[model samples]
Target: MTSDTAATAATPAAAKSPRALARARRRHSAVRFWRAYRTHKAGLIGLGTLVVIALAALFAPLLVGADAQSVTDAPGEAMRAPTGEFPLGTDQFGRDLLALLVWGARISLTVGLLAAFLSVAIGTVVGITAGHFRGWYATVIMRVTDWFLVMPTLVLAIALASVMDRSLWTIVVAIGVTTWPTTARLVRAQTLAVESRPYIERAQALGGGHGHIMTRHVLPNVMPLVLAQTTLVISSAILTEATLAFLGLGDPTVVSWGGLLQDAREAGAVSAGDWWYLAPPGIAIAVVALAFTLCGRAVESVLNPRLGVTR
Candidate 1:
């Protein structure tokens, strides 16, 4: 009888293990989303393109022996069509277009990544506090966000970057500071939804502090939204950097896409039928941005099935 009872108890515990695993499997739906996303052709291509661009930008010097900033011409190398020496071609200034494009990835990636990180950091804190706390803190945070939202992000960045000697760091800070409102609003909505969930309420009732509730209970749920927003914002930041460079506010010191375009314009590449100068950087920007955008759209579809999901 003792052995029978022990066996029966052990069976229930063993059965409960399966049930617990099933529940955990259901709770983390990210795996399902990834599995679904993998089947998406655009998602896979965009991901691949992004990886290639990141790698090229990171290892431009190693990948291409030609200096991105150096205007080199071997007389034979001058304005050469896409050949072994210049896979992409040479610029109007006789600079290696391929080298410029490869190096420009560094600037785009830097601006995008740094700005996105800053926006997320500031937005997450303000958003969590505002939504979870729900008081003057919330009001103040939202109102400040409102003020930022009203300001023209690109225009503001132009003004700020222009005034600060037009350095890479200046552009990074300017873009980061101006482009956080969208993230804050998105995160705040997610935080609010998370705070009202049954688990969150239960945590609160179980003597969890506000900080503990926000960090432990709320953060995990809202992270998906943050991640989705990150890809999209990085795309926007890259474009913004290009725009700054186009408008003569780009760092002349670096061979970024914007600077490449600027050099083309100055050298009259388009007017002179040297489409080589204008096309490469434009294509580079479009390619990188398109990759991010495609991935963002796919992630958005998964994260927020309906527009009402507020991720």
Candidate 2:
């Protein structure tokens, strides 16, 4: 067969095997994303730090050799400074500060991740639906999103948490629901841009269903932004959870970084100048928040260079 004939024959086989084509496309996109990602060194560092924090939180109990909830005074052990045995010292309640911190890390990170995922899921759906439909539906959705945008997120979350039972899941839901408007607006804007492209028009012309076009085309195109937004959401969610915990709205049963801070405050750690009691949790929050912010900025810069974000 001639070269042209061979090429035509392969084209039909290629079209017949969509899974192979899809795998190839995915691999290509992964490579492209990695290339873009490597250009941001700070982002890589932030990602590394984030990973370390996660691992530390996950293995807290094993590393500490004690349950965070365990109270051990053993005669005048309360509020002691760091020693050979207790690296982070003890709280006023005689719980190991290091153990509490480890457990707190787990809770804080879990809340951050779960809340961000929920927020992003809601935002992506609302955004894609509004942007793709573009009519009265879009108008209504946008208006609702705008209403959310106008509301004070922290205040709304505080109100929701105050009304609900204090639990980890409740706090997560409160933060997630309150924080989605920004992601929705961002996704909607990106969806509008993606939908106007020629490929989307061609897909529509080819009789692609709304579901097919959105899931296969528009979502992939806008995912980088969604991912970037999710990272930022995680940071905000963590902060929000901490704030709620500080106000005594945290799950009373669970130990979280915020709860530790609350415990310290109530115990007069600040006034007593007990750095051991006060510093670790505060530093943990700051470090984790900064890591997420750095990673988010890097992803945002790589995916949307038009925003003109610098390192």
Candidate 3:
């Protein structure tokens, strides 16, 4: 009896070892998204670059060891290329370009993230509402979205920004508002497809509430579209915000990459041979946007597969 009991215990332990090993293998598989993320190599590189940029942006203050608003007391002058201390060089005002660039990253990422999220959130709600509920409700929601689709995004954003007193929030909101139409249209299409599935029909037969059916079944089906759209929107929002900031439509109080461009342009840094003043911010915006575009496109192609794009 004792021997049989010990054998049973040993059998259970032996069985668990393979299960643990399988679980680890499963986890390892999930991390290799790049292996299947082909069809957009540039996008992958861009995505990777953005990740690095975001990390640096997040850690900028610690890296600089200085407050963003605090000016250096040193009698520093501007238009110089990179030195050991200020790798990116100083602007006309003698503020450390490295520090300002790092600080500016915070603004760029903040606008990118916050504006993207707001755009996604608003678009999702409008899309779902229009798709799941037909008749005049859908017509009204879609007609509003049409205005967004037709209007020139930058011009509309400028007009909106002009009214809001030029704060960071104004930039964020303007970007969010203009960018939502695409997401809404995508969501509405997805919802239309999902609402017709047999499972949804069964749920309706069972007297499930509209909220429950939408939340549980319809929403999950549309989520992939939402996630993929987020990457593209983040980069787009950042670029738009930067454009507004550069144009003097942005809040004058805030320091953004666009604001830097505006300063550099106003100072004639390019004509006067201050390439350092103009290069970093432009490159940063381009790199970040390219990264998102690549990564988003790659993931979308992989998931949808029928797009037939080559690796």
Instruction: Give one digit per residue, the lDDT tens place, for model 1 in 281-306.
Output: 89989988899988887787777677
- Stretches of candidate 3 off by over 4 Å are 1-35, 38-44, 72-75
> Model 3, 137-210: lDDT tens per residue?
99999999999999898898888898887788888898888889999999999999999889889999999988
Clashes of 3: 4
Give the range of the ten consecutive residues with the poorest summed lDDT in model 1. Answer: 71-80
Q: What would the TM-scores of all predictions be?
A: 0.84, 0.91, 0.85
lDDT of 1 at 126: 81
Q: How many backbone clashes does candidate 2 have?
A: 0
TM-score of 3: 0.85
Candidate 3: the clashing residue pairs are 39-311, 43-294, 46-291, 47-291
Query: Clashing residue pairs in candidate 1, if any?
Result: none
Which ranges in model 2 have alpha carbons more than 4 Å from their true place? 1-16, 72-76
Q: Name the TM-score of candidate 2.
A: 0.91
